[model samples]
Target: MNKSTTIWGHLSAAPHRSLFLAGSFQALLTILWWSIELAGRAGLVAPPLLSGITPTWVHGFLMVYTFFPFFILGFLFTTFPNWMNGEKIRPNRYMAVCLLMVCGVILFYAGLFAGKLLISAGLLLMLTGWANAIAALFHVLLTAPAGDKRHAWVAGTAFVAGWLGLCAYALWVLTDNTDMLNFSRQAGIWFFMLPILLTVSHRMIPFFSSRVLENYVVIRPFGLLWLMVGCAVAHGILHLLDLQGYAWWADLLLAGCALYLSYVWQFFRSFHVRLLAVLHISFAWLGIAMLSFGLQGMLFWLNGGEHYWLGLAPLHMLVVGYFASMVLGMASRVTLGHGGFPLKLDHLTWLLFIAFQVVIVLRVIPDILPFAASMAPKFYLAAGGVWLSCFLLWVIKYAPIYWRARVDGKAG
Candidate 1:
């Protein structure tokens, strides 16, 4: 019996399909909700404030927790088996994760209009789903036959850290402890998402580039990878300890390593293929973001820790510029390759990606230009609008492929 005939059947047909499909919907929903909130803040309209919750805290929580894990777990679930040549993850396993997470997100939205109790309850559900995801991936890691498990191990360890971070968030919701919330944000980004994203990019980018360009030398420095990961953790720890001014060396060193990789990757050489080009471009943002962080920290230190420069621009570059763009590019490449379509970035998708770059710029502008500080809310609203537009357009272009039968007559 072919399961591809029905919508539900097609969704569960593959690990990536169900997870990515749900993630795509989430990608739209999270940003749309945030954008509306931003509009209200900018005096565009009046939306009801969250109950017993600071909007910024909730915003950080939603972005950190509800959003990227869908794509991250989906990518890991789809790739882990092949990476280890191990047992395949069962449908029920991923479906359980998807259903729990989706329901949890819905409850979270309901909680926004309700109270802290609902919000805390919603996070508990999400935490459970997240734990299930980590366990499922760990099982794959643990059961794999004797082989190279560096990537799997690193990623799996990061998932555990992420799970703990989610727990912190839940605890924060319950106790109103800002320290827990802060730890959650730092752990979620630096310890968890950063490591996983870099690991994936490190593993995949050079391979993809090597295939397309003749005589391309793959330059993956594992030592550098370890160093960058260390610096990332150190930066987070410094912030946790309120020693941010001392993190200049780590941030700068990381910036150097990342920028060196970009130069070696040969950005201009891959533009002939838009798909490969996007990945390269996305990877380049890491260097740029870190450079911003390094310079900001350096400037802060030089001025006796008096004035902070660039404000949130560096962080935005990391979040949207590198993380979001990398997810978009990699997800698109995977979708096309797996769905039996030509592995090319079409003009519409390409334009949407370009527009996303504009979003990053808009987001960073208010922080950089001193005069624009007063208009930060308006700029943020515009940035949110552009960001939503990008995802909305791109999701519309690709979401159907998740559930549709592959056009190449291949099973998922």
Candidate 2:
């Protein structure tokens, strides 16, 4: 068997290739499915169909658990070894993870048509994949150097939390338990995705900026890090305990910290380079999202649950603005750097990234325009449509690099 030229060989050659490729496709597919469902529900198409789980729950599950993990795991697998001077993750280990997860997601889509049993089985498989990733990361943590393993430790714990959230989701699929569903959704956002993304941003964004922007001082304060983490976890715990109203303090503090870092990280200077600009722009949304969350919560509390302005606005901002934008920026950088291309984006991709900002606006418009209740679904369709299109184009631009050898003749 010629291992060098085979598709399998190329895919499994590096940890990021197959996983990132799969993630890009998953990102496209999930949104496409959502857009279809939205159109159908809005009566722009045929009647909508429901699988074993309700569409709302299904959307939450896929967005939180399925879509982002592939990219997250791919990035970590490539960086963890370097981060800790630990051993590179074995191809077999990450391969097992990728295969299991890809198959599990396919099964989930299929399960939508088949039955609840198939859906349950799919969830179990995904949980197993999550377990595999967690174990691999845990190994890195165990062997990492003693100096400042805090990011590693925090990111590792977030992965573990995500796995637990997947467990909760699996239980929800199996038993139709709302509590499990709620736990999975809330924990996936706060305990799982937030910590990891924040740590990566805190660790990398400044580092990335300093490398490109002259006179950029990289100030990574551990005190600020812990404070952000504290506020995030506190807010998460408060929401989980159904004391969401009291979370205003934590959310406001988080917003302030995020904005402070954005400024100190030289958000203004980033526009000098498109690649760095994208990362800065994405991080900018975190402050906006948190500010929205805190202000909305404060209003709700102050008005005695009577004035929740901008319902769902903050979440859409986080997911589309912060999460997806970072994914695009980070993944673009990874694909270019790892694939032996120049570290800059072209005009077309830059425009696509701008389009993503439009997507955030479209999504949040509906939330803020709750007065236009009749038009909300139309706005949902528009947001979903734009999101699907952007990712589709993005996948087209980047996915091929994963399967082909490096352009510069360097091995991955």
Whole-structure CA lDDT of model 1: 0.87
What is the number of backbone collisions in each predicted candidate, taken in the order shown? Answer: 0, 0
Q: How much is the lDDT of residue 126 in candidate 2?
A: 88
Candidate lDDT values, in order: 0.87, 0.88
Q: All predictions: root-mean-square deviation over Cα?
A: 1.5, 1.4
lDDT of 1 by residue, 101-204 (tens): 98888888899898877777788888889888988998988999989888888888888888889999888888889899899989988999888988898888
lDDT of 2 by residue, 24-133 (tens): 98998888888888888877788556675688778878898889999999999998888888878999999999989988999889888888777777878888888999
Q: Candidate 2: which stretches are off by over 4 Å?
A: 1-5
Per-model TM against the reference: 0.97, 0.97
Q: Assess the local accuracy of residue 39 in candidate 2 as a C-alpha lDDT between 0 and 100.
A: 81
lDDT of 2 at 2: 75
Residue 179's lDDT within candidate 2 is 87
What is the Å distance of residue 268 in model 2 from its true position? 0.4
Runs off by more than 4 Å, candidate 1: 1-5
What is the TM-score (0 to 1) of candidate 1? 0.97
